[model samples]
Target: MSVSLRVLDDGAWVSVNDSRQVSVSELWRLDAPEFCSCTVPDFVVENFQSVGVDGRTITANVYGQCIQCGETGVPGWIPVGRLKNGEYVDLDRENVVLPAHDGHEN
Candidate 1:
């Protein structure tokens, strides 16, 4: 099954499959060193810049500043929330796996 997500209330809520699976405040807790090429301790997500569905995974383009270097903007997509078997998980950041970026696109 495909998954869809949307940013509501200006990142206040992330509607996954027409249900709120995660919130902006909770995004702050997500941190994956392999996702971005930055050395920041964590990506402080303040807003949801965009959202898209990729196969069975729901991707989210988050806009936030780096907690360490202060770099701001959407670094890339992160899978914070998910919906599997019609069950909602409270927190699921471990499954966030970013595709290898070899400094090439397309």
Candidate 2:
């Protein structure tokens, strides 16, 4: 029994055809006791030149290995956002189908 997801749809993920893309959720890892001010990982937008503000969300790209297989298959993505209390939030979603970067056709 496989379940599907969608954006502006229902559940955690949105289904587009046979594949599904879920809005990744992340919990910010605060090094300091204060939540209002925290540092984010670099990979979470290292490729981008600027950091844009989107409502309460701060989008970024991150890198990590698969915990299960220990394979460097895909780099994890981090979705950062600020809470009403000024605390930062970050969540890591694994195995995201990222855009192809190689010269080969996608």
Candidate 3:
């Protein structure tokens, strides 16, 4: 199976299969100590710098600010969603604490 992943609208949205599936301005809980010192940084999504797929997981290199520590940068590839049977499935990004993937399996 194949999926089309793209960063669109000047890095404001993540287009999956040519359709806008994710967007900026969302509050995401992150477990990224390398990006910030906060135990669980309250990340505010500002841009979708890039997007890729790791197996069934859909990941994104996002540019955002940590509301707790005010740290801003790309926290590596963060899992934004997943592919189930070749269909994109949205993750509960806002409610869950997403871990940043630095190219290693997690």
Candidate 4:
């Protein structure tokens, strides 16, 4: 299956197929070691790119920063959505990298 994704709410929301899926206004464990020191729950998405879906799983590489450290160009993924109910599964829990990210569900 195919899915669509985009930034909403001024880079605060990930709109999956035109629907809001995740919010960046919340706190998250940003896994970008090259640009974050999120050892204290202090990160926010500054930007995103390359959003699309592989199979039924959504994928999008992300760019963010540490709110405390003031870093940028942090690489990650934007979780567009997940599959369930039919051989159900959560895409965010998968071990495959779609550029980067683990659902960015802060």
Candidate 5:
């Protein structure tokens, strides 16, 4: 299946299949040690640098701040959602701890 992914509204939202799906300004719990010194950072999503798909998972290069440590930068590729049956399924970003992966990883 083909999915159209885009960073929309000047990096405020992620457009999937021409529709706005994931968005910025949401607080996400991140398991990203590389992003900050905190074991789990309370991340505030500031922008969507880019978006892509890895298998069925939708990932984004996100620019955000760690509310706990005040660290700011792209925390690598963070999973935002998933593609299932040609439709977009939103991840529980606000409630769950999402793992941030290095860009080189599969």
Candidate 6:
């Protein structure tokens, strides 16, 4: 049983395969953190906000549509924010980093 995250943007689906780990509780928390109030997942999103002072999980709405194809369910934890140049900023910053591609194929 493999599930994936699908973000709906610009009438198209974007794959957020950041490690491909799925949890039902985590998704529920992200959709409505105030109502659910679950611990924030160990990932970085652009529009993560803290509604409460306790400061655990983020209480922000993911402002995109589901992009995962074939009904794999809603994509989990998409940080909502203003992105520059219509390009996505990578949220994964763990371990030693690799050089970002400058649109030049090697």
What TM-score does structure 5 among the candidates reach?
Answer: 0.95
Model 2: residue 95 alpha-carbon error in angstroms: 18
| TM-score of candidate 3 relative to the true fold | 0.95
- Comparing candidate 2 with candidate 3, which one achieves the higher TM-score? 3
Backbone clash numbers for all candidates listed: 0, 14, 0, 3, 0, 4
Q: lDDT at 8 for candidate 6?
A: 37
lDDT: which is higher, 2 or 5? 5
Worst 10 residues of 3 by lDDT: 97-106
Q: Between candidates 1 and 6, name the one with more favorable TM-score.
A: 1
lDDT of each: 0.57, 0.28, 0.90, 0.53, 0.90, 0.25
State, as a TM-score between 0 and 1, how close model 4 is to the true structure: 0.53
Candidate 5 lDDT over residue span 46-101, tens digit each? 99989988889999999989999899999989999998899999999999999998
How many collisions between residues are there in candidate 2? Answer: 14
lDDT for model 1 comes to 0.57
- Estimate, for each residue in 1-106, the C-alpha lDDT of model 2 and write its tens digit: 2222123322333223234332323222322211122232111222221122234444333323333333322232233333334434432433232221212110
* Candidate 3 deviant stretches above 4 angstroms: 104-106
Q: Which runs in model 2 stand beyond 4 Å of their true positions? A: 1-53, 73-77, 83-106
**What's the TM-score of each model vs. the native?**
0.64, 0.27, 0.95, 0.53, 0.95, 0.21
Error of 5 at 60 (Å): 0.7
Cα RMSD for candidates in order = 4.9, 15.8, 2.3, 6.4, 1.7, 15.7
User: Considering only N, C-alpha and C atoms within 3 Å, which residue pairs clash in candidate 5?
Assistant: none
Residue 100 miss distance in model 1 (angstroms): 8.9
Please provide, for model 3 over 10-95, each residue's C-alpha lDDT reduced to its tens digit, 9 standing for 90 to 100: 99999999999999999999888899889998999998888988889999999999998899998988999998888999999999
Question: What would the per-residue lDDT of candidate 1 be over residues 1-106, giving only the tens digit for each residue?
Answer: 5555577887877787678766664435334465445643356667876676543455677777656666667666665544568554544553343332112111
Q: In candidate 1, how many Å is residue 13 off?
A: 1.5
What's the ranking of the predictions by TM-score, best on top? 5, 3, 1, 4, 2, 6
What's the CA RMSD of model 6 in angstroms? 15.7
